[model samples]
Target: MQPSHRYTRLTAIALGIAGVISFGSAGATGFQIRENSVKNQGRAFAGSATGQDDASVVSNNPAAMVNLDTTTIRTDVTLIDLTAKFKGGGRSGAGTPLTGGNGGDPGDATPVPAMSIVVPLHGAFEKLTLGAQLSAPFGLKTEYDSTWVGRYNAIESEVKTIDLTLSAAVKITDRFSVGAGFVYERAEATLTNAVDFGSGICANPQTRPLCLTPNPTAAAFGPQKNDGLAKVKGDDTGIGWILGFQWKPTDALSIGYSHRSEIDHDLAGNITFTKPGNVAAVFAAGGVTTYNNGPGGAALTTPSTDTVSVTYAFNDQFRMMFDAQQTDWHSLQSVDIKRANGNLITSEKFEWDDTMMYALGAEYDFSDSFTLRGGVAKDESPTNDTHRTPRLPDNDRMLYSVGLTWNANEHLSVDAAYTRITIDSPDVDVVSSSSSTLVGKFKGHADLFGIAAQYKF
Candidate 1:
């Protein structure tokens, strides 16, 4: 087979595999990271300063650890259910006619799992508090069935990430405190999908002649079927830091602020392709069969970013929190491919931009043992019309949530919350080098559910 043919087949297989690993099996929304204190949720994530109960406070603001008054150990676990539905155009030829079809299998659900722990240290230190934490703050998965209309575009993707943090808080005065921490994070991803070039383009008279070459295999197999799967795997790690402060102006009021730095991760993975017997038969007859172990894998990396937040309290009856976050998505502009032989295959450019997210929440204390919370937030999408792919058909989204905290006793507390998210389909256009016409007008939507628990020592 010609180099171009080998390249095309390999590309399809790689994309299919990456699609399955990164999106097909992965949830639509990446992993989620929320502040630790039950009171922080009421302000919509505003608790960078006033967090006192759970380890999440280490991520929100380490200074708040000084308020615990005791060597406290806390842990929280959350479970999320996500549903994504696709709508709009289906499979189509380059120039003839277009059809509306759905991608992915029916009744697919993505589950998100998260856990965190915070520990405070004492003994030799009278004014210092030490803490540690572990949790997943970012990642996502999206996948469709093989028969779906958009199968040629994407199939499935699964991505996961985790972070570990160590921190120290010090009381500078009777009412002032400060804290800082070192952060280490790790991430992994897998994607898979099928590539359909034969039926998609070879059947069209106008496009067929241009993509086909004289082949004995095509005659033996009675025509070739351009269908195959590709898979990509990757992993990487990085380091960052955090800083925060807290002030208690009076016995009845307190304020806090904190910032967590972003850490960059570089993922290294391999891509593989498998061809069916029928397709290989066609290539064999045409004397056009060729295969490389697989395309040289690439190194994928996403930039680290920062979040800042504040919290305020009035007596023990009421509290409010506000937060803002920035993500350096601009780093995703391209995926560069480098071969072990020191050859540069090609680069996939994705023109994404930096985004900001904001939220607010409030809490009401009904009694010494009971607290109620509610909040709202807005999240931004990282893809644009030109770069959008089936693996992550996302858009700006809005969230609303409510929860309750029950203090089982002085050291044990249980917290539960539910949130609903909604996003409108983004307008996009799809095209391929092997086809004659361009495809357009795709849309979809998704929903989410979550729950969590905490214990303090």
Candidate 2:
């Protein structure tokens, strides 16, 4: 077959495989758990020891569940709005430039939801407890208009993830407790873009007749059209485990620690390349062109991960929490494509590395029914400046939060919290060789609203 035909067919297969994996995974973003309890917001999230809160206690340190006085059930819901701004940056050179345009503006917003429930096995097993939780640990969504000028690298992209967990807590002694749990997770993602071939260079038809050589660009573009969109989706399921321990050396002092193991996922999906008639006609008008055919094969593998958290409580009135996490991003080095006829096409290597994050929080009691909390955290950027794309122009970020809890009555309580995140713009280099750098910066801020109901029987 002609090179153009081979390229189109291969790309179509890759897009298809990616789409299958993304959709099957349930659209997970892997954004991380922002809230575990109404009270947790105050101490930054120190519930590992003073597991007074029902939901967070189970997810953060299940062993603490053995201390419950009665069987209690709780649920919380949170809404988040994020606004990102891009500033600075200029476009130079004439080749269908890859960067520039409203280089500074607000991007998009994201919303997240979570829930958990815990029960004590008192009569038959006084020292044993069981609990379950549903949360979103990682996720993000971003879309840049095609006219934004960064279209060559990325235009629109979104990722969403969900995790369901079941846990058991057991008390080893009056002063020590241990626990373990299992997790089921799902994820999904989508990316679309239209790369440009400058009118003078690749598009010139004259100066370089072979400018349209059947290479990576031709294989990716095909005869379907010079400008088009590649849509891909993927999904998968995976298993993970968690272990935790808590120590109460004295009535006034408590210490706790927990570790969660990572889960590996293999994603499968479908991809579709849509081109304008002008572009498709170039290959074969009203018929199959070297580009109009479907390629249909590709796969992505995401590796396992780990997280550690520690909590310390001084008396029943005050507490503090610390958390750290590491992700195996290196596993995402490249997207491998396989043709149905058993052939290897091109590979897209991201060459990503591991990343780490840190967080701290504290809480204080104001009265029997009122509590106050505050926390701060720092998160590192995952992408380097060389490969940064508008789909996720993220940089290192700082977070600040405050919260309150009110005991409305013996059987009821109310919780509320607010958090803000700040990000700085980083210098970015586009794909174009001559016009490599773009002048600009990015900023983002968000607000959160939450409410939860708890009851004891």
Which prediction has the highest lDDT against the true structure?
1
Report backbone clashes per prediction: 58, 60
Worst 10 residues of 1 by lDDT: 20-29
Weakest lDDT window of 10 consecutive positions for candidate 2: 20-29
Once model 2 is optimally superposed onto the true structure by TM-score, how far is the C-alpha of residue 356 displaced, in angstroms?
Answer: 3.5
Off by over 4 Å in 2: 1-33, 36-38, 45-51, 88-94, 98-100, 103-107, 197-226, 285-308, 328-330, 337-345, 432-440
Instruction: Provide TM-scores for the models.
Output: 0.82, 0.79
What does candidate 1's lDDT look like per residue over 276-314, in tens digits?
665555455556533334444555444445666555676
